[model samples]
Target: MHDHEEHDEQDSGGGAAAPARAKLFLEGRYRKLCRDLPQTVFYCPECKGHPRRRRGCARCEGFGKLTRDSVQELVGWVAGKAFGTRKHKFHGAGREDVDVRMLGEGRPFVLELLGPRTFQVDLAALEAEINRRNEGRLEVRGLHWTERQRVVVLKETPHAKEYEARVAVELAPGDPRAAQALAAARALVGTRHTIIQHTPERVAHRRADKDRERWIEFLSVELEPEVEPEVAPAPALDAAPELDAAPALDAAPALDPAAATAAANGADAAPARTYWRVRLRTQHGTYVKEVLSGDSGKTRPCLAEWIGAPCRCVELDVTAILDEHGGAEEVVEPAPADDAPFGTGI
Candidate 1:
C-alpha cells in the first residue's frame, strides 16, 4: 500500500530548466486489469533495471520491470506525450493497495508536467485521451492547471478517508454464539474507538515497528439479508405459483413454510456465512486492512475483536477523501485497581 500521500522528488525532463506544473484531482478506479499495478513504476529489484544486467535477467525478461505499466505510467504516457516531456513526478493524497479499487469522489493527485514543450494544450482533451487510452484499466476527472504550492499542501496536510468494505464473516447458524456475534457487531456501530496499533505485518519491513495510536468511527454496518432457498428452482418473477407443485395447506400441513424452506436449503439449515458491509471513517495513516483483520492481534480492539470472528476484507472501495484531519484524542490504558475488599484494610 502506498499510504496515499507517498511521493518522490525527482529532476525534470529539461534538467536544470524549470518544469511546467499543474495540479489535477485524479478521481479514478483501478479496474480489474490494472489492479496488480502499483501507483508508481516498480523497477526490477534483481537487476536494478540496468540495461546490460537486465538483458540477462530472467526475472524481468530485460524489460526493467516484473510487470507492464502502472497508474503513473498510464497517465504519464498520455500527458507526457501531449506536453513533449518524458519526466514528471506523481503526488497522490494517499495511495491505496493496487488490488483495492478507488471509488466515490476519488483520491487527490498533482502532476508535475516537467518541461513541457508547450503549456497551452487543452487540459479537457488531455483528460479525455488519458481515460480513452486506458478505458478499462484506469480513469480520471478534474484535469486542470495549478501552482507547485498545491503539491506541498497535498503532502503536508493530513486527510482522513471513508471506505466501504465487504467482509466475509463466519458464525455457526442456529447457535447461541451467532446471536452473540450479531449483538457484538451491532454494538460497535455509532461508536468511536481509539486503539493501539503496532506496525502491520504486511508493511513491517518498511514501516517503523512501534505502537501508534489511531482512531476510527463506525458510521454504519449492515448485514446482507439471509434468503431461504427453495427445494425446487424458484419460479420466474411475476409468474404464478403452480398449484401442483405444493400440496394444499391442510393436507401437507406437516411441513410448514419455514420448515419446508429450511429443509430445502439444508446445509445445516442455514447459509451460515454471509457478507457484512461496513462503512467507516479512519484517521490518516491508519491501515484499513489491518484494522479489520486485527493483523494477527497486533491491532487491539479491532473489528475482528469486536465481531468475535475471523473477518476478511474481500472487497474494498474508498468512499471519500475528507479534507479535514480531525483532532485526535490520546489513547490511555487505565491501570488495574487493587482487588482488596471494600470493608478490608489494604
Candidate 2:
C-alpha cells in the first residue's frame, strides 16, 4: 500500500507538470490594401464580443465584428486552414487607422498559431495563398520563421513612418488663393518643425488624454482640381523612382469617388472642390489627422492655422515604414494611375 501511494503521488505530480498548450510563431510583412479594413477582428462593442444568446448578437448586427473583416481575420483564416489550427493571434509592429491603408513593403507582423496540428509549411506558398485569397485587399511578403520574442521587438521598436493625406481646403476651387496657400505649405517642406499634439478627440476615449511633441522631418503639399463627373481624371502622377531629396508635390493622389463627387460643385460654381496631396514624414505615434485639422487647437502650428482655413484629412495612406537604421523590410512599388482603383495609390 505504501508503494502504491507513492506511485499515485508521482503520477499526480507528472500530470501537473504537463505543458498548458503549444504555440507557433510565424513572422512576415504585410500590406493593408484597403482603408476600410481593421488590423484585427473585434467583437461587437455593444455585446463586448460575447453573445448572450446563440445564432446572433444585438450589436455588430449579429456579425460579431464592428467591421465586416480585418487583416487579422483575413490572414489568420488562411493560415489556420493551412496549419490546421483555429486559434491564432496577430501581432503587428504598429497599426494604422481603419480608414487608412498601409502601402510600401507592408507592416511587419507575427502570427502566433496555437495548437497547430502541423509544423511543416511552405512559407512562400503560404504567402502566395494569403495574397491570392485576399486579392487586392491584403498582401503578405517576406514570410519567414521567427520566435515569440520577435513580437516583443516588433511592438517595442520605435519606427518612423511616411504618410500621404489628401486634404481639402475651404477656398473656392478656382480661387487663386489656393495657389498662395499651396506655396506656403510647399515652402514649409524640408524644414523640420515641432508641434504639441493632444490626443485627438476621435481616439481620446481609448488613448490617454495628454500632449505629446513630435517632429515633422519633411512635408510637401500640392493642389489638384476635382475631376468633374462628366470628365475623366488625368493620368496618375508618376511617383518618383526613389524618395525625393526634397518633398515634392503630387498634384494627383488617390481620392474617394463618392466624396469627390459630393464636393464637385462648390456653392459659388467657382470649382467647388480642390484637394491638396500632402506627403509628410513623422515619428511614430503621431496623430497625423490632427496635424491637419489642429484638433480644435490641440495641435499647434497646424496646416489649418498656417493657411487660415479649415482643413480635414479625407484620405490617408501609409507609404512606408522605416527602422532606426533606415532599413526597409520591403520596397514600394509605383502606384497605378488615377483610375486604377479606389485604394490602389501608394
Candidate 3:
C-alpha cells in the first residue's frame, strides 16, 4: 500500500513529477513621495492596457497610461526581482487619490509573490533594496513575513483617518462679516457630526449615484487674509445720489423669504478671496471634498453650511491612519506647510 501511494503521488505530478511552486507573503508600508503618483497603474481607458500599435494609441497617445508609474509598480518590480518571479499581487490597506499626498508612517500593504523560484530571500534585505532603488520617489519599511489572511484583514478593516485640507472661502478680506464666519468655523472643533453625502459630481462618473452617511469625529478651522493691496473704501450709502430718490418711495420692497432666511443664518454675507486651513478626523471612506462644498446640498451639514459661506478644498493630505489598536502609523513628516497653502506655488 505504501508503494502504491508513492506511485500515485509521482504519477499525479505532486512529488517527482514537477517542482513545487512557492508562495511568499510580505507585510510593510508604502510612502508615495510624488503627488502625481497613484497607488496602482492605470491603463488606457480605451485599450485597457492592450495597445494595438507601438507608435501611438489614440486614447493613451501611445503612453499606455494616464500616469507613468505608481506605488504598486515600484514595489512589485523589486519584489518580483528578489523572488525570481515576474508575477505578484499588491494589496494596500486603503488608497489615496492621485492628487492627494500620503504622508506620515505610510499606508500598510502586502505583496504576494506567486510561483517564486525560492522562498529563502531575506525580507530585511529586500526592503532595503526596494527602498534604495525607489529612493525619494517611494519608500518601503518594516517588511516581514506575513500570512495570506493579512490581505483580507487589511482590506476589510475600517479605521479612522486624519486629513488636512487647504480651503478657499468666498468671503472677502477686511469685511466685518469675516469675523463672524471665522467664529462659526472654529465652532466645528470637538463636535461629533453625522453627515449624509451624495456622490460628488467630479467622481459621479465612476462611482455609483448614491447617498452614504459618515461620521466626523473632530474638525478645526483657521482663516487668514490674503496678502494683497488694500481695497478702496466703499462710498457711504447716504453719499450716493441714486439713493436719494429711494426715500421718496412709500415703502421698501418686501424681502424675499429665501434671502431673509439666508441672512438670518449668516449665510448671505460671504467674503471673497479669503482662505482657511482645516484639520479634520473622519470615519473611513468619507468624502472630504464633498464635506467642504456640500456638493450642491448633497452633503448635509457641511463646512460651507457651518461657516455660512461657499468653500472649496484646494489641496488635501492624509496626515495619519489609525490602526485597530488605536495606534497611528509612522508619520514621516508634518502636515503640509500652511504658509503657501494649497493653490499657491509648490
Alpha-carbon RMSD to native, per candidate: 16.4, 15.4, 14.5
Per TM-score, the best of the predicted structures is 2
RMSD of 3: 14.5
On the 0 to 100 scale, the lDDT of residue 153 in model 2 is 86
What does candidate 1's lDDT look like per residue over 1-346, in tens digits?
0012323544666545343343332222233244576777778888978878999788888899866887788888888888778877788767888777776655667777665565445665777788888887777765655555666777887888888888777765566766677678778877779988999878876799999998888777787676677689878878966576666678854657787787777835544665678899888888888888888899988888987888878878777777556443222121122232221211
Clashes of 3: 9
Q: Give the range where candidate 2 is weakest over 10 consecutive residues by summed lDDT.
A: 1-10
- Model 1: residue 346 alpha-carbon error in angstroms: 71
Whole-model alpha-carbon lDDT for candidate 1: 0.70
Worst 10 residues of 3 by lDDT: 1-10
Model 2, residue 61: distance off in Å is 2.2
Estimate the lDDT of model 3.
0.76
Error of 1 at 54 (Å): 3.3
Colliding pairs, model 3: 104-331, 104-332, 105-330, 105-331, 170-271, 171-271, 171-272, 172-271, 172-272
lDDT of 2 by residue, 1-346 (tens): 0000122222355464433456777777889888789998866666666655313765676666788888999999998998899998999999999989999878988898887777666666778888988888999886666667778989998888889999988887768887777777888888778999988888876899999998775467877656757877676678536655655578557797776776775433553556889998877788899888898899998988888778888999999998653346443332334234322332
Better of 1 and 3 by lDDT: 3
Could you give candidate 3's per-residue lDDT for residues 67-88 as a string of tens digits?
A: 8988888898888887788987
Model 3 stretches astray by more than 4 angstroms: 1-20, 53-56, 224-272, 323-346
TM-score, predicted candidate 1 vs. hidden true structure:
0.70
Give the better candidate number (1 or 2) by TM-score. Answer: 2
Backbone clashes in each candidate structure, one number apiece? 3, 1, 9
> Which runs in model 1 stand beyond 4 Å of their true positions?
1-34, 56-61, 172-176, 225-272, 326-346
